[model samples]
Target chain A: MPRLSADQRHCVRLTLNGRAVEGEAEPRMLLTDFLRHVIGATGTHVGCEHGVCGACTIEIDGALARACLTLAVQADGTSVRTVEGLAPEPGRLSVLQAAFRRHHALQCGFCTPGILMSLDHYLRSHPLPTETDVREFLGGHLCRCTGYVPIIAAALDAAERLRNGETDA
Target chain B: MKPARFDYVRADSLAEVHDVLAAECGEAAVIAGGQSLVPLLSMRMARPKVVLDIMRIPELAGISLDGDTIRVGAAVRQAELLAWSQLKARQPLLALTLPWVGHAQTRARGTVCGSVALADPSAEIPLTLLALRGEVELSTKAGRRRVAAEDFFQGLMSTARADDELIEAIRFPCGRPGEGHAFREFARRHGDFAIVACAAVADGKGVRLAVGGVADRPVARTFAGLGGSMLGQALDAFAHELEAREDLHATAAYRRELVRQLGRQVIEEARRCRA
Candidate 1:
């Protein structure tokens, strides 16, 4: 079989953060690139192109997935939520984001977007999570700073606030 | 790094998959979860001419149980299996091993059949399947057939599947009454590939042991006389025979020790669960 030229591109259409979005991508264009470049949602950071680092984590059809490992074409017709989608509106932090800030959950801030997105999706189902549960959930992500203490605390605190029906500003 | 350009085709049916595989032959790579293949593609480790996306095939999705066997479709993601309460009750070994496959995010997209087909020596899913003596169904343009997990895995990143064959599903025998199962792996980080791992399934009469990350392929053994107390000594003796190789992460000797210790712990845990 002959190798395909790198110039080939496919039309990709997907729902981005509750909005219908369309983009053209090479078959090899990663979902992370499509989210950051074509869709212009730069909040989803890409740390490791490999799946090991969860900095490229996002939600596809409401399930958490690694955007780095998913092709943009694979996400055609799917709903995706990146870190940019976590906030209720632009310029205002969501409850999880506020909790992270209050608890000083970030230092380098490179891993924060993925961690926040992961916790944002996780806390919805696990509103009464324990420290172990938070740790287990955060295990997918790798953070170089903050030693994960603040992050775990932030996640637990956010879970509490969300449980109490706190509104995002 | 971004992957080199390739053509993408989504197969909507089993026939479409077979036809695509037949036409593309060795040039096409199937993309299910894209958990492993996508990484390889980005690293330029794999350069296929075309990538066949099998996620849209309705026939290749869903989980069903028949009397004593549970069938998990190729498109059924690991997260789906983890969330499947009935599967947890029926195949406790899978339930025990699913979380260790990767993280919640990877599992949310990774499929059981994809893991089995990849046949990664360090992956938990293949080791669990080997421990359970599961069967993988392969389909072609002609027909479909089943291969035992033991025979299906040939070597590192190799399997018995032909170029034209697509993995249809995998069938695992339902956990029997009094069957207790435990899975444990030692990795530097939670989601890192294991340095050594073990899965144990035991009843009062016999025990099945499968070890991964210590050799070219995951290995399984059955011992009729083994019990929780005897597992440590038995595994210690068995570890000496493993073809463990030294890698940057660990020495061969260290991996053997891991197999010995983790094997015993899993067996003991299974025994406790049974009791």
Candidate 2:
């Protein structure tokens, strides 16, 4: 029953990457901007604020969503996961991240964070994925660098490693 | 690009939504998935004075079978609807077209009714609905009414929904015992908007074909057991009747050609399975 007016900022609270965080944002603020500028978790990159590029992809309440397409106030009371949450520990690479490193999946790393979030969520639900499935899922993302072949290789390799019970590298 | 400033409201009940909507009149935009609306907002193409988030309303969030109709709630995400166990069995047309609605990432959050509300000329859902003879349930504070899919879409990116009305649900009829349905789309990328999309439904007596991305709105026509070159002629007439225009992705001639070629393929596929 609360109407958060556009001209004023309101306190928006949500769980971010396992930690409870709150930020003040106007009703027009995008989740991506709130995450980077207000909460200071810049791991989630923003590209094509209109949601074409998947650089702004993240998990909202365990569902894959484009941060650029979601409003900050709409995320209130929900739990969000970003690329910063992918690692098991500081300085430790998750299996998917390790595979990307091994395959040299990234060139400039501008799109790596969002790609990691997507592959991480996808491989969890579909533990055993075919090469074609990986390619189809990757269609959501646009990577100008590496031409996506290495990214596909890394995703498949990570799926194999995870299926074999390897947690980290 | 950043969106123009707008007020926000998280409504927990239909009454609250109706109140704000009725008060704001035409200046309020309802956000349910934000997949299509968000882009319009960021581009400043649609600058609503206030955005009412309707997903929080518990009543608007489910899919159920009411007799032969699958009533899909406004809050039901596209992925959730596709994952319904009874989907492919009951509504094969939707099961086939839902995957082509958007990418897995976008479908994970985009709602089925949101796509209907957006009413893109080339959207798979609208075309499929019209092909299936589905209906859209629109509601306001006073009451609700059902509009047949054919009447719901007025033109490109337009619908008959009033300013105070919210799309409560969409009713997709369950497939009949002996009917057959098929869908085909051509897009440069898998998730991009289609250059041309077709949906066909065939019965023992006749076949209904719906074409999108060619005109102001999706167009459906019925053909009665036309064979070979006759069917081709009907398709040619439909293609030319659409007055296909040249866009950056395709030429008018190319779209007309697709209509001729793809049109015949869907009609053939649908008729082939009609038992």
Who wins the TM-score comparison? 2
Please give the CA lDDT of all the candidate structures. Answer: 0.88, 0.93
lDDT comparing candidate 2 with the true structure: 0.93
Estimate the TM-score for candidate 2: 0.99
Cα miss at B42, model 2 (Å)?
Answer: 0.9
Question: Best candidate per DockQ, number?
Answer: 2
Q: Which stretches of candidate 1 lie over 4 Å from their true place?
A: A1-6, B227-233
lDDT of 2 by residue, B162-272 (tens): 999999999999999889888999999888999999999999878999998988788899999899889988998889889686889999899989989888888889887
Q: How much does each candidate deviate at the interface, measured as C-alpha RMSD after superposition?
A: 4.1, 0.7
Worst 10 residues of 1 chain B by lDDT: B223-232
Model 1 residue B58 lDDT?
83
Candidate 2: regions farther than 4 A off: none
* Residue B176 lDDT, candidate 2, scale 0-100: 94
